[model samples]
Target: MSVWLPTAPCTPRDCAGHLGARRAPLPAAVLLTAGCALTLLGVACVPAVLLLGPAHRDRLIRGWAYAVVRAFGVRVRVTGVTAGEGRSPVGELVVANHVSWLDIPLVATVLPARMLAKSEIRTWPLLGPLAALGGTLFIERDRLRALPGAVRALAGALASGSRVAVFPQGSTWCGRSGGGRFRHAAFQAAVDAGAVVRPVRIRYLTAELHPAGAAAFVGEDPLAASLWRVVTAAGLTAEIRVLPPIPAGSEPDRRALARAAQSAVASDSANRPAESVHH
Candidate 1:
């Protein structure tokens, strides 16, 4: 198929990425064939610390996340200064671009923040329990009435000095020119909690050093399928850039804050490559 060359995650936004439906499956199959031992090891070691508590569980999860991407042969490079030198923040909302399902583990690998996710994810086979153990806050997306309560919970968490990471985009994207729009709903929590919204940009690179569009779980993709594609994809890298926090107070309201924060992140990543890859 004809497509754009992704050279690396630093590729220009206008660049086109091929939808590798044909190319991803075979490598995914082969990777899975070799992934059994690693998978079993993780399952055996990681879950053992689940009942300990949120802090212990989150740290273990972080270690597991590191093991996971490495096990799958994926490298990660993080840039930008995180608030408080990477320690969790009290009144800060971490807003990031959602590129793929890998964003979750990838982010968690760096900072132990409470993530806001859809309620339905709680029903997914094992992910539900794992996310719960990780202290994830689930929002009832189907019930609009529950939104305020969810926001309230997020605000409460932030006020209580817990770091919260949310994907204002609501869904994943291919990390190309038009990744996706940032919805304003999630921003309310920041306003309510008087927290500054920190914008984070996440991008995926193919093993061949190109932007890996197929790594995104945008459409009707199953969890297993996305995982297979990511692990099987060669030389894949997850680059996360934590932009400076946009002060919510600077904006009049949540909507303006959301727009400003989104633009800030978009402009930062679009303007140039990351300052430098993390060591």
Candidate 2:
């Protein structure tokens, strides 16, 4: 769970105002704890979901994901479809910008894909086991030597007609001043598997649908503190936009694919409409 924490300083005025807003204004512990408990319950159901077969597993997992977001007091609004509705593009590799931990359930609900995660996520409390069981492919990021194997594993999953998701930025950031550079590793997986590279953008908003500073998990903010910030918000909303898929033919190499996907996400995030949907 030790992701990169940018040492970027907070604006003095922004800090003073945000500090006043930091007071835990609601029963955050109760809500967040309940969310965690329910998510674990979903994890417990995974074995059974698998038994029901892959198609059933996806629907059940999606239902479970939707419930988790409710418990967190966040609403979700989605635009477009992952590879378009009803069209299951084989080897669908979904790539999205990194934001908060909340991004997982938010996006997973839309596309029932296995996540490609850092090995550190396996160390998280209750959520870790759930993620692992939910079909996350853990990469020992510290070991550069393991990249090829990890990429091949991802390719294998994609080749099997299972969708996979990754945060190509490789780290989270405060999206207000723009996002971090997208790394090319995940795109290589797309290339290796000949998968459809789907770019997604995740935005956190307040009840009024404005950007939520409290929701961004930037810097060295502890997980507990981040959870508290989310729980205390009167209400938060996460928007997931599934842009058009980029196939191998569109880009000559991994670098081209990665750069194209990154630009798509950045452009979409910037030009996205202000309208918000509640559900």
Candidate 3:
């Protein structure tokens, strides 16, 4: 298989079990409707929002992302070291593990950047148009020959002072683990652009703060099913851990850099004092 098309062992039947009793059906219905409405509202506003200045656009995107997650009744808790600390304002490669469709907006809440998404997403209903308008970089995962051009496009974006967010794992995994590991291809873009890597780890939790699996969008899981699971799961919390930034040129090659970033993400750093936190 092509590196861009790596698969994960996680399946919905095995890795995405419900954690507890879900929200009352009535409340869940309200959340579901509200979430969809908020998403469509954002899509409708994308064209107008893009017309604003970069700073204004970013703030709007961040706020919109946070609102979308919140609308689904999933509270976001961000912790760990600050992502942009001591780094250049632009050109940082924000990398994270994939868990659900929710990962896109969740990452945007903290690190709003040009997203790197699979070409398949370009055809996905309202999200497709929204992502395109948001300047997402799409990769043709099935076409190995297209890898060079994709990397070049990503590098060009980063080199042009644009922060880019990429899920280097290529595919979403169970939030707990088993996504095969980060592919080095995206890391090459960072290296080429001389960009710092901001590694982030995301987890879903119950109201009591224990691990929750209902949010994982794994094998054979339809988007509707995943979205329903999120909206109905009362008090589902997405805890985003932004690990320390890996300095530019810190690794000799993409492979080493990929490994370094993955190590930081996979490490058990929960007990370590977080540099900051945001609700």
Among these predicted structures, which one has the highest TM-score? Answer: 3
User: Which of the two candidates, 2 or 3, achieves a greater lDDT against the reference?
Assistant: 3
lDDT of 1 by residue, 1-279 (tens): 111111123221323233433436666566655444544554465447656775676667667776665655567787776423654445778888877767876777666577899888778755566666556899877677787788899989888877788887776666765566677777888888888787888887765656776567665567776666666556667887777778778899988998888888788755755366542
For candidate 3, write residues 128-155 as lDDT tens digits. 8889888999988999999999999999
- Model 2: how far residue 254 lies from native, Å: 0.6
lDDT score, residue 204, model 2?
A: 79
For each candidate, give its TM-score against the true structure: 0.79, 0.88, 0.94
Global Cα lDDT for candidate 1: 0.69
RMSD of each predicted structure: 6.9, 3.5, 1.9
Candidate 3 regions exceeding 4 Å error are 82-87, 268-271, 274-278
lDDT of 2 by residue, 44-70 (tens): 887777788766667777778878887
lDDT of each: 0.69, 0.76, 0.84
Clashing pairs in 2: none
* Top-down TM-score ranking: 3, 2, 1
Q: Answer with 1 or 2, whichever has the higher TM-score.
A: 2
